[model samples]
Target: MVFQPASGYFCRALGAVLVIAATGAIAFAQLTIDADSQYRYAQSRFDSGAFDEAIVEFNRFIHFFSTDPRVPRARFQTGMAHFNTGQFQAAAAIFNQQTVNYQGLPLDNEAFFMLSRSHARKGMFEQAMLDLHNLMAIASAADTIDQARYELGWLHVDQGRWNEADQAFGQITPENQDRFQVLNLQQALALSDAIPTKNPTTAGWLSIVPGAGQLYGQRYQDALTAFLINSGLIWAAWESFDNDQYALGSVISFVGFGFYAGNIFSAVASAHKYNRDRVAEYRDLLNQRRQMPLSLVPSPGGAALCLTIDF
Candidate 1:
C-alpha cells in the first residue's frame, strides 16, 4: 500500500501555497502601479510638446501594458504625437490601425476622423474623402455624422471643390447647423463663385500677340519684357536679312519665333497662376474669419475636443 503523507508535510504544502498567492498579488499590484506611472510620464511628455519623447514613452506603455484599459488612449496619443511632428503618413497608419482594432467603439470614430485629417494633410484628398464618407455612412449618432460632414466640407474646400463642399455642408441636419461655423463658411463658399478669375483659354488666345496675354493677366512687367525681347529679335532679324547676312537672319528669326511661342505659353501660365493665387487668397480670408477647432484638452480620464468647428 502507498504511504500516506505526514501531517507536517501537508502543513508545509499549505504554507507554500499561501506564500505564492501573496507574492502573485504583490506582483500584480506593482505591475498596475508601473503601468500608471508609465502612462503619466508619456502624457507629460506630450503635454510639454516633446513629441518624439512622448512617442517613445507611449510605445513603451503600449508594449508593457498591452492588456491595460488605457491602451486605446495610449495608441491615440501615439498617433497624435506623430501628427504633431508632421509625420503624417506614420500618423495615418496608426489611426487606421486603431480604427480596425477598436471597431464599434467610440475610439473607432475618433480614429476615422484623425485618419482622414492625416490623409488630408498629406494631400491624399481621395483617401481622406473616402475615410470621412465611410465614417458618415457607419455613424448612427447625429453629432458624429455632422462632424464627419463638416470635415468632408473642409476637405472639399482644401481641394477648391466649392460645390462639393456646399453639398456636404448642406447635408448637416438643421438642428446641428448652429454648432458649426456655418454662416461664414456658406458666405465663403458663395464668394468663391464671384471671385474674379482669369480664363486660361482666353489668356492663351490673347497671347497670339507677344505680351498681350501677360497684359490680359495684369502682368505688366512680364508683358513689357516679352514685348521688348520679341521686338528686338524681330528687328535684328529684319536688319540681318536686309544686309544679306542670311545665316544670321535665319538664326535670329528662329530665336525670335521661339521667344514668341514662349511668350504665349507664359501668358497662359500667368493667367492660371493669377486664378490660383486668387483662390488661395480667398481661402486665407475664409481661414481668418473662421474659428478653427483643433485644440485638444486633457480631461481627468482622457482627452476631449475643445471646439466643435474644426477646419
Candidate 2:
C-alpha cells in the first residue's frame, strides 16, 4: 500500500492541458490589449474632429472585437461619428438599433438621446419629441430625466408651442431652471401677439375682387399688377365684342377669366406665404437666443453631460 509514480500517459496528458490553457490565456490577454488600443485610437480621432476617420476606426474595432465589453461603446461612437458628419439618417438608424438591442441598459439611455437629436436635426420634431418622451419614461436617473425634459422644451419651442415649452422648462431642477429663464424666453413668448398673420380664407375671399386679397396681405405691387391686368383684359374683351369681333372677344374673355381666377389663387397663396415667413423669422430669433448649450462628452466615469454657456 505505497504511493506509486503516475503513468507516462497521465503526465503527458497533464502537460498537454497546461500547454492549451497557457496558450488560451496568452491569446485572451493579447485580444484585450488589441481591443483597448483600437478603442483608444478611435477616440483620439473623434476628439480631434476627424469624424470620418473615427467612424472607420470605430467600425473596425466593433468588427474585430464583437464580444468585447467596449463593443457597445464603439458602436455608439460610430453613430456619433455619423452624426458629427451631418449624416443624420445613418446616425438615427444606428441609434435606433442600439436602443432596441440594448434596452434597459445605460447604453439605451444614450442611444435614445442621440436618436432624438438625430430626428431633430432632420426637422422631424414630432419624432424627436417621441424619442425624448421614451427616454424620460425609461430613464431612472434624475440628470437623464432633466436632460430629456430640456430637449423636450426646445422641441416645443421649435414648434412655437410656448405653453408646452414653459411646462417642460418648469420640470427641470431649479438650479438649471434659472439658466433656461435667462434666455429671455418670456420676452420672445410675449411677442407672439405682435407677430402679424394673414388669414388665408380672408385673403381668398378678398381676391374675389381681383387684387384686393393681395393688398390685404400687404403685397401692394402684386395688387396693382393684378388689378391692372384684370381690368385691361376686361376692357379689351368688351371692346372686341362692341366691334362685332366675336372670335377675338371670346378668346379675350377666356383669357381674362383665367387671369382672374389666378389672381384669387395668388392672393390665397400670398397670405399663406406671409404667415409662414413671419413665423420663420420669429423662430430664427428664438433660436439665436435659446441655444441648448448642453452636450455629452467622454469621461473617465462613462460619460458626462456638460453645459456650455457663451457670454
Candidate 3:
C-alpha cells in the first residue's frame, strides 16, 4: 500500500472536526433564537397589558428554558402581571419566592418593593412593613435604601403612629425633605386635636329630653327634626287619650312610643358615628402614597431589572 502524506491525513481529520463543530454551532444558535423569540413575544404581550396571557407565556418560557439567563426576569414579570391583574396575594407570593430563589440579581430590591406593595394593597400593613424592612437590610444602593425609608414613614403614618412616622422620616437625608415634611405635617394634623364626641350613654339619656342628645352630638338639623317629630307625635297621642278615643289613642300611643325609642337609639348611634368620623376624616387627609417605576428589561445597564424612583 502507498503511504499517505502526513499533511493530507491531518487535513482530513481537521475537516471532520470542523464539520461537527459547525453543525453543533448551528443547532445552538437556532436554540438561542427560538428561546429569545419566545421571550420577546411574552414581553410584548406584557407591554401591551395582556397580563393574563403574558403570565401563561412567561410560565411557559420558565418551564421550557430553565437554564436561560432570562428566566429570573421572566419570573419577576409573572409577578408583575399578577399585580396588574389585582391578584395581590399571588403577586406577593411570587415576588417573595424570587427574592430567595434569585438572590444576587439586581432585581431583588424591585421584587421586594412589589411584594411590599402587594401586601399594602391587600391591607396587610404589618407584612408590608416587614418586606420594606427586608429591603432596607439587603439594599446597598442609596435610592433603594432611601425609598424604603420614605415608604416606612408613610406606613407609620397609616398606622397613626405619628411618633414612629417622625422617626422614620428623620432617618432621611433631607434631599427631598420638604416633601416628607409635608407628609409629616399631614400626619401631625391627622393625630391632632379633633371635635369632641358626646358619650353614647349620656346621649341616650339626653335623648329622653327630646333633641338634646343630637344637639350634644352637634347635629343641629337632626336635633330639630327629631324634636319636632317626637313632640308632635306625643302631643297627638296625649290628646287622643285625653279625649277618650280609645282606638285612636292606642294607635297613636304605640306610634309615639316607637318614635321615642328610635330617637334614643339614633342619638347613641350618632354619637359613636361622630367620633369615628373625626378619626376617619383626618385619616383620609393623611392617606397619600406613591410608587416608583420598575422594569425587568435588558438594556445597556445590563442588569435584568431596573428601578427608577420618583420622589
In candidate 2 the C-alpha lDDT for residue 297 amounts to: 48
Please provide, for model 2 over 156-220, each residue's C-alpha lDDT reduced to its tens digit, 9 standing for 90 to 100: 98788877877787788866667667336666776877888999999999988889999999999
Please provide TM-scores, in order, for all candidate models, with all chains considered together.
0.83, 0.77, 0.70
What are the lDDT figures for the candidates, one per model? 0.85, 0.84, 0.79
**Model 1, 77-175: lDDT tens per residue?**
889889888998999999998877445556678788889988988989999999988887777888888888888887887788988988888888888
Model 1 alpha-carbon drift over 4 Å, by segment: 1-33, 101-106, 294-303, 306-311
What's the true lDDT of residue 209 in model 3?
82
Clashing pairs in model 2, backbone N/Cα/C closer than 3 A: none
Error of 1 at 230 (Å): 0.6
- Candidate number with the higher TM-score (2 or 3): 2
Candidate 3 scores a C-alpha RMSD against the true structure in Å of: 10.0
- Per-residue alpha-carbon lDDT of candidate 3 for residues 1-311, written as tens digits (9 for 90 to 100): 99999999999999999999999999998767467788988989998989999999999999989998888779888998998888989999999997775353457767887888788889999999999898888767666777677788777767767667667777766675664564555456555465455699999999988888898888889999999999998899889989998899899889889989988998998899888887667666665433345545443237455653322
